[model samples]
Target: MTQLETAMAILMKVFDQYAAADGKTSSLSKAEVKTLLEKELPQLIKQAKNKEDVDKLIKSLDFNGDAEVDFEEFVVLVAALTCSCHGRQGKK
Candidate 1:
């Protein structure tokens, strides 16, 4: 697979791995999201000034007002973070 395809596959796999924690494969619960971030995105979590920042991030990712985050919402978070990081790279 191409690099982009591999990345996409990895994203799906990671989401599925975390989302399955509560026997729900379609979405991620708040706790699952937190664990995913803590374990998968440790750098981002470390950059968070406090727990509230992480809480706010998880809340914001829930676009449908549902307590859980679906795959679309998860992709948006990843895309936004990618854009932010890419923009920073351009500046450097």
Candidate 2:
């Protein structure tokens, strides 16, 4: 696979790995999201001022009003974070 294909596959795999934690196998529960952030993106979690802020961040990512994050919504969050990080790197 090309780099982009590999990246997309990795994204799906990661989402599935976390999303499966709650037996949902499709969407990520809030707890699963928190665990993902804390384990996979510790810096992002650490930057938050407190647990409430982290909760709010996760809540904000739930765009479908379902109280859980589907793969599409998770991709949006990942893409946004990727863009944010890329932009920061460009500024340096």
**Which model scores highest in lDDT?**
1
Model 2 segments more than 4 A misplaced: 88-92
Q: What is the lDDT of residue 8 in candidate 1?
A: 100
Instruction: Give the per-residue lDDT of model 1 (tens digit) for 1-92.
Output: 99999999999999999999999999999999999999999999999999999999999999999899999999999998998988863454
**Residue-level lDDT tens digits of model 2 in 1-92:** 99999999999999999999989988999999999999999999889998899999899999979999999999998988998988863454
lDDT of 2: 0.92
**What's the distance in Å from true for residue 9, model 2?**
0.7
Q: lDDT (CA) for every model shown? A: 0.97, 0.92
Q: TM-scores of all models?
A: 0.93, 0.91
lDDT of 2 at 8: 96
Q: Model 1 has how many clashing residue pairs?
A: 0
